[model samples]
Target: MNDQDITLSRRRLLGSVGAAGATGLALGGATGALAHSAAQEEAPTALRSVGATAVPFHGRHQAGITTPLQAHAHLAAFDLAPGAGRKEAAALLRRWSRTAGELMEGRPAEDDTAVGRDAGPCSLTVTFGFGRGFFGRTGLRDRMPEALAPLPRFTADALDPDRSDGDLWIQIGADDGLVAFQALRALQQQAGDAARLRWQMTGFNRTPGATAQPMSQRNLMGQVDGTNNPKPSEPDFDERIFVPGDGSPAWMAHGSYAVVRRIRMLLDPWERLPRGQQEKVIGRRKGDGAPLTGGTETTPVDLEKRGKDGTVVIPANAHVRVSAPETNGGAAMLRRSFSYHDGFREDGAPDAGLLFVAWQADPLRGFVPVQRKLDSGDALSAFIRHEASALFAVPGGPGAGEYVGERLLDG
Candidate 1:
């Protein structure tokens, strides 16, 4: 019969089965079934999903100048009360999005395309997402809420000591350093003492042609990075995003996992290196992301090939070598790293580098393991140092709510 008829038939069969059982047994069985159903419903999705949008420059700012508009990233964790008002929080987000766009000359809206002037008045666009601990049939689900059915997927996570929890992360971008601080102040007012927020700022000159390239391409090293990242409009987006399961609930199908790293790059040492040596270290041309072994950026790397007297051409411990296909464990993470040019030394020298952001399905298999392997003395490590690191559990699907440890504040 038709799908609706089949559903009705199944309901009738269940009803008949219940009627045939004794009253006491039926009641006990129903309660047990409900508990089982809740447990199944609460399980996190198998794959992480992501949705992202770019805010471009369209106003009086230097279209290509690399040193005017400063960029910064911020993150915070919330210890939400058991009955905290999520609707009010979501309402604040909606209001903030509108106010931020207005403050930036109407450029913060999802579809707004107007670019603002450099070093001029600007607004901020705030993107939101759910973490792994937020999903499922917990009481928090009924309390936490979202304005829309499918929330925008932006990279934001709190600092988790272990890799088991996700933090409520909010990233703010602006033209002026003061503006960034102002945005954070406003967020704190709305969130109150219910949540704790920690933020880091990275200010740099906005480069021309930035809008033409993907977010993952621009790095502090003045190079187009992460050319190997999955393209946004590719057909594989669904596969990379949603978990595989016919019985999976509709709400959790479109969520993604997020990972954040506060990496400090030693630019002086790197810039000191001869351009040729730099190229060799990265295993690719600095100007273009082409492999040293030859071919375009998209070409598969020839990692197995030997150079000269049978030594590996790319080298076993090179940044690209360790991060490449040879040691990635056959898993790919969509990276959207941002160059942060702040935290200068006492002598007025540059000290900051990149806020490395990556998204994938499984943190253990996808990011953690790969990073652990790379930490074993890769060439890139010479120029870069991991000053701070944390893992966040990003939840997937609809009706997914705030993180698990969030209710600790209520206690």
Candidate 2:
């Protein structure tokens, strides 16, 4: 490669090394040698191109939700420290917003962490949200939307309270793992004495340009997931996913509700099922994610179609059938999720699943009804476990010189 290409390759190598360090991956002789050789060669376009991809922190809505999914992400929740109330929370958010905006533009925060310097912004996005309990902690209960109420217990939930909810939530995403980690670490440091981490979850999706061309991402279960997610191009997308300004609480205008779930896939059982049986469970083709009785991934599912034997083509209890908006009074949510693999469990099974994050204007109409149906008898529920859950009200993107939740926290 030429001199310029070599410089880019070296940056890619450094980025890889930073990722290894972030993940606590020890670099031995063979790995180090391999990394050196790989660095000499041209890096993938995705790696080299990502450093130039930047998402603005100030917008009509937060960046992470609508921005295409990044390859790496960190989801964290924090509880306010004792004696830290609305004033403290507001100041913290201000600090965070300033830091997020700077970092997202490939600039270091006032307190620099060199973790992401060599890397471009990689479309870094930092989104903030408030949990239901946050209102009580900040003495702003009257500002809390009824939609922010705790989700009703689901039959399939084996929730860990310790990792469930908190007063504040932060979502950091970037194509590069180190960049994402750096942002997470910086935010945690910025929290100072105002808040302490309650729980955090790391997740990932396919890197942009990893495949030959763009396509939908697949979850751990190997299904092309999120095919039905609402698109910005859709006429009613905003209405369906964002709270209207006319809603009761003025502070929440243009905001959205996020339902986050740590779902553990029962891989052993799920993998053992025959492909046909697996298709029956999800009601979609494994290879292309098309509806079983459909033409393409986006083709409307014909739930009524049946086989010669007079059985439903997409099983009655199949996931797609149960969760389809049509079956739920046209309810919809914009699903943007990541796959997580946290190594093996004590029982030797893989502890991995989808980090399901769905955004909607209202959870009661968006997630609750659909999930309740799934709880009753969605075929796919048998192969997955809901281990932790949280719901947060994510306000609209901050305007210039403002931080997220400024209205509720300062008004």
Candidate 3:
């Protein structure tokens, strides 16, 4: 593989964002609303150069972590088959890495199904990671990064073990629906007998160049998400997201940790509340994502502002207030989530919610503290349930002629 394979073009990215608003999905950035319907349109025409855009596969960091959210995604995990270990895992990664590189560049495999043969790259990305048990399964326990610690149980957790973690994880995203599906199917085949599928969740976001400009990335509950997301330009963004070379685990240098959760929104009950009460719950103006205290979307939330009744304008238990970095010792995570709808349930309610994927240098400093705060009293907790959870040590992007995880598996 070429070292130059993974760099994203800044000019191309900017063009995707129209002046008026953003496309529906801009992952790893400010939140925007995802429009869901009774059915997903296969490939709803092309927009600008969406189909021609390509995200390089080889870089210092994995692509999907900071790459803009694609319109469609497939999040799945796999457990190693019996007797599979380091040797087998390495070979699997080799095949996966090669195929991922080709597919991401809009090339197809020999066994390809031709699902997106003419769709071009569509900004596709296929990211790989290792869960806690992955080390033990591969006999690389000693090389495992301590950052893969188990997540503490939260009050709102009603976790289903079957749908949670796995020995390995894969996140596939693309601007085009068919291209995303093609990547998912291609990678699953590459797993071969070395790994068995555990759980899979399909998600979608607003397509690039969808709106006149970029609009809000709204969730199923109809709220603007990602208002306070940390930007790459932030001085401490890389320090907080990617592990430096001086990090403890030698193999994980430049890598980051990921916390994946399937949070189901209680939409029926939430929709019952009037829009005003809903805004009060989140402490933001639903229309523009501005703080209730006033100003635009980027306005600083007034935590100290009080109403006429001497109560804080943003409720003490409001999600925005509770999850604020100031309130949680400056703990922050780059949240790149995709909205999911698994159709209606047997109970006649929609099984729709978010596939929340958060990345940080260390879980202890990023997701843990903030989530702990939310666990205690984030008003949004009332409307969401943590159904599945996982923690993975997503190693840094591979160097030239190397596959993902080459350092750990070969070191």
Candidate 4:
């Protein structure tokens, strides 16, 4: 399109440039507006700012780990195709990386699906990781981090093997659903003959800018989750959440371990409980997530506090009480979770719950200890079932001109 036509097209696409929800510019009359439009013919197209906010694909670490939770996400795992060894894996990663770089910048890949062509980048991110089976498949087991060890069985687990682990994992997130879906589709196509899809899960959170004020998101059970998530500002945040460069296995220096779980809440039984009973089960206020012991949401829990009846406030078996770091030798995980609903079950009950994704320097110290405690006797466990689980070693981000896992795959 010519300069004049391009400008006019943008103006119309953005609705007269000054109309409500447009560019917010107000060029009063047609004469004045035409003059302004002509002067700005060469100016970049303005189609609202949502799509313009891009997250760079290259960095010291993958984007989704510490990145803010997005509105939409797709978590999928793949197994290397038969006879597809290290060489094939390396080539696949190269193609995947290039496509990811383009998509994250709101640009189309060479074989773009056009699903999100009209939208901006919307803060898209694609994170890659290696599952335990991946190492065996590619004959790189020696390079896999010890932290990727299999999790011990839990009492509350009803895991489905088919939906559990795979050779490769991908996490795609974006503020826009179409953008997220487009990225997922592109990556799947790129896998081609090198890998085959194992399992996939879709999830979502409250949309950014949807709430009048920022707050922790609520799950389908209507409870505020992630109130005590570790922040990057904390003194021990990096030490606790990411692998140290000095640690063994050079390729995983800046990486982290991810514990993926599909926890299904028994909503029928849970919703039957009274509000007061539910609060006791979680040991938090139903409305605002404040500890039953007292004070606001951010206030530290007073485990010592007793009620008028001399019973401990914040019930002994409450979910928060059992999972608290203090109760588990300072164990904690950086939870970046999303709620998922995969329609209804054959029994007609809603099939939904949290796609619990937690990151830590070591799963043994972070997820294992805490989860073991919960499995033993957590009151919340009665209303939730662990349906699927997987652990992955997510290496540091690839440098410029390098694809993810290039070090290990190409070594």
**lDDT tens string, model 2, 191-218?**
9999999999999999876788567999
For candidate 2, the per-residue lDDT at 244 reads 86
- Per-residue alpha-carbon lDDT of model 4 for 5-32, expressed as tens digits? 8555544533422232132222122342
True lDDT of residue 377, candidate 1: 55
Task: Indicate which candidate wins on lDDT.
Answer: 2
Model 1: per-residue Cα lDDT over 1-411, one tens digit each: 786885564344333323322332122223323432333325322110000111222211111111122344344444333444454344444444444443333222333222321222222333334443333323355433232122222122223344222335554555445545555556555555444444444434343223664333547776657776665477764355333333133232333445666667778888889988887788777766777778877676688878879887787776777886447666567665567665688876586787766665445545766676676757777777665454443323212233212222131
Q: lDDT at 247 for candidate 4?
A: 74
Least accurate stretch of 10 residues (summed lDDT) in model 3?
A: 31-40
**Which portions of model 1 show Cα errors greater than 4 Å?**
1-125, 129-166, 173-186, 203-216, 233-237, 241-251, 346-349, 393-411
Local distance difference test, per candidate? Answer: 0.47, 0.85, 0.83, 0.84
Task: Report per-prediction Cα RMSD to one decimal.
Answer: 18.6, 7.6, 7.9, 6.6
Name the Cα RMSD for model 4: 6.6
Off by over 4 Å in 2: 1-44
lDDT of 3 by residue, 309-398 (tens): 999999999999999999999999999999999989889889999999999999999999999999998888889989999999999998
Looking at model 2, which ten-residue stretch has the lowest summed lDDT?
21-30
